[model samples]
Target: MYDFANSGYTTVVITAVFSAYFVGGLAKGAHWATLAWTSALSLSYAIVMLSMPALGAWADLHAGKKRLLMLATIGCVVGTALLAWTPRLSGTEAVIAAMLFIVVSNTFYSYGESLIASFLPELATAQGMGKVSGWGWSFGYVGGMLALGISLGYVLWSQAQGLPASHFVPVCMLITAGIYAVAAAVTFSLLPERAQPRVDRGIGAWQQLRSTWQGARRYRDFVWLLACTVCYQGGVAVAITLAAIYAEQVIGFKPQETMVLIFVLNLAAAGGAFTFGYVQDRLGHRLALSITLVAWMAVCLIAASVTTKGGFWVAAAIAGLAMGSSQSAGRAMVGVLAPPLQMAEFFGLWSFATRLAAIIGPLAYGLVTWATHGNQRVAILATTVLFIAGLLLLLPIDMKRGRAAAIEKSPA
Candidate 1:
């Protein structure tokens, strides 16, 4: 339910609707919008990268995941709701405000993701981790699909009523915020916290972070997992951050067409998430991740080479499949490897790795696009290198050894 709630924010406000709207409608053009969007994302992730380890350590020490989750969720909801007002004003000031709103909301959403993920190991056994993670991802994608559908329906309905098309974006943002708050209530009500005693009540954030850093050498497999995740997720972040803009700019998709494309992608992604979850458990995380990385490479190649809309659609479908599978497998791997007593701290490091990827990937893509005068195809293809790098890193990881180390180190 938490995943479902957050997915609405991600899909409606970040990925499917507002990003393109920000670029096309608010930021004035793709070139500036892309630069602004990437900058905002880089700033947000930089904050997360610096703070996540401390936040995770604090959560671990204080047993405060649920509390932190609630706080982050509220932050996202409020930030998204405020976006509805962005369209009411027009000027350089409004554009900057809108971008700031997106950055703040996305930061909260990312923090919520990390906090909720820390609960995974407590929710499922190691053998069942893949399925549980997959279910969460599938559910999130369903939420995304539904959220996009709602936004699309609103846009169509407003047009049928002869309302200005410009009014649709704000209304959709409101709907997204409402959906997130209502759906997230279920998560807060039903999910168990399973609190653990504070292991280091006196531990300061910096000390905890430093200890986590030093402990990496002792947990080599977990460190390797983080390295692999950083590379592949860098590729994934590029695809997610740029997909809508890519469709609009490169493929000449209208806003309505882009929404529909995202809707279909969400459906495909749900199936991929579920299937890969089963594969993760049966075939193991490393194999599942490798398969997804290979699929991502194909997606990048296809996206770069495709000229026709139909070809792009095909690429989108492949991307959808790989995106869901890769993310689900990566989260499940963290659950499988994190020491039971230090789940939040480990997942914090997970967030750091992911946030770093978030920073690097979009910046790289945006910089390349800007340098080439808005040539997004080359930038899209460049992500293939990230996936290849990740795949090479994954090949050396020993999943069994990682799991064993977690068990051995766990205080439980």
Candidate 2:
């Protein structure tokens, strides 16, 4: 169900549909709207991260974990429903509305993730944390692939019938939202309740926040892992967010062509998630992550130079492989390294790091696009450095060893 939401909500609509629509149609002439939307989205991520630990602590203290998840998921579903009306706005109204949707939707997404993490056990040892996370990602790709394919068929069928192009946009948004709402309901029904933290004699939110910060500093490698995550994750976000627009603007793909390309990418990503997650369970997260980053670097370089839709399609498939594998393996690594009872708090901070990149990656993309006079390829080329830098930072950290160390040092 989480995977369902991930694919339909995050990948299809946020990254592919509305993002492309906004850039290619809504404010085509005013690139600043794209810039503002990306910037605000990133900032919202930081805000969520900064506050998530406190919120997680509060949930623990209040013994209201499931209730919080319900609230966050509801907000995301409602906000996504509102996205159906996004195209109807114009000028400043469009920009503001898009930004609001992205921020609010993302906030709901991140908080819900923290809630889920609260349930993962503190120990599994050799199996690693990759399996579950990878399952979510793999199925997410499947869901996204299904949604994109259906939406694409609808658009192409409508076009063949000489129907208006604009009609498909609202329909896609509504479908994405409805499917997500259904998934949320399914998740609530099937997922088990998380074990609430035992009351800490007198621990308050501030104390938990301080302890989380201090505990984080005790593990020096955790900070470096976060740095790597920020860089690579930023690259991923920037690539996913802008790929549709880039294909439309630079690669000269029409709407139907773009949808097909995105569908292919999702298919490739689904394969990557399943394969790499299984492999990482045996091969180790560090190696798995490093391999994916290297692949991403190569993909970015080729994408930057590619001009034709064929070449872009090939590059998108390659990027999808990297995207799926990294997300699955990376979260597993985080789950391994995080403190035993502080999983939610740790994952919350990890979310912040990824979202932090969300801020930097998109703003950088927007800034480069603006500075280069709408040459999106240049912006893409610059993001290749993020991949290389991240791989380099990840080289020294042994994820297996890190997880062992985290486990050994955990309080009973």
Candidate 3:
């Protein structure tokens, strides 16, 4: 349910509406707008990358995941809602305000994301983790589609009224934040915080983070998992952050049309996650992930090659399937491999790796776009290399050994 709630922020703000609005509306379609948007998102990811592992460990030590989750949830919801005020500022001020607000909101959003994911191991056994994680991700996509659907309806209506984006996009922001707030209220009311700590108080979370790296070889497969995530999730990050921009820029899609496209994409993602959950458990985690990475590579190639709108839709739908399956598979793998007592801490490391990828991927795309004078095809083509690299790294992982080490706390 938390996934259901928080997915709205990603769907409407990060992937669909606000990004397009920030780049096209507020920035007046400035050449630097796309790069500015990616920079702001990357800045937030960097903040989460640096801070979350220690915070997760602290939450474990103090049994405060719920408390911290509450704080993060409120911060994100309020910060997102406040984005409605951006359009009221002067043009330069609005751009700056949007960037600042996105940084704050997305930071909190990422924190809540990591915090909620840490609960997986408590709810599902190792053998069942993949299916359960798939269910969560699948439902999360439904939430995303719902939020985008609602926002799209309003955007269509407001366009019919001949209102410009300055008026309507703010309404979408409020709508997104409202859904997030109401839905998260349900999550907090029903979800249990079940963490039991076995940490040494003298070894603080920061020290543990350092020692975790120092003892990297002890968790070799897990480290390899992170490495693979950085490679592939970077590709995913590019798609998520730039899909709307790409549609607007390269495919000549109108704002409302892009929203509708994304809504359908979310539907595809939901189906993919739901089906692939059981498939991951049956086929083995690494194999399922490798398949998704191959699919992602296809997405990059298809996207790079397509010039027409129909062709782009095919690429977008395939990207959606790969996105949902790959993200679910990775999270489930973490659940199967993390010690129960250190669940949050390990997931925090997972969050760190994911966020770091978020930074590198979009920044790379942004730079490529800038250098090529708004050439998105070359940027997208470059993304395939990340997926291929991730697939190759994935082959070396032995999930059976990783899970055994989690249980035994010794090298496999």
Which number leads on lDDT?
Answer: 3
- The TM-scores of all predictions, comma-separated, are 0.98, 0.94, 0.97
Error of 3 at 251 (Å): 0.4
What lDDT score belongs to each candidate, Candidate 1 first?
Answer: 0.88, 0.77, 0.91
Q: Give candidate 3 regions above 4 Å deviation.
A: 197-201, 410-412
Candidate 2: tens digits of C-alpha lDDT, residues 243-342: 8777887888887877888888888888899888888887878888999999998898889898777787778888889889998887888777876766
Candidate 1 lDDT (Cα, 0 to 1): 0.88
lDDT of 3: 0.91
Return the TM-score for candidate 2, rounded to 2 decimals. 0.94
lDDT by residue for model 1 (48-91), tens: 88888899888888889999999998998999989988888886
Per-residue lDDT over 373-395 for candidate 3, one digit per residue giving the tens place of the 0 to 100 score: 98889999998898988888888
Ranked by lDDT from best down, the candidates are: 3, 1, 2
RMSD of 3: 1.7
Q: Per model, how many backbone clashes are there?
A: 0, 0, 0
Error of 3 at 243 (Å): 0.4
For every candidate in turn, the CA RMSD to the true structure comes to 1.2, 2.1, 1.7
Candidate 3 colliding pairs: none
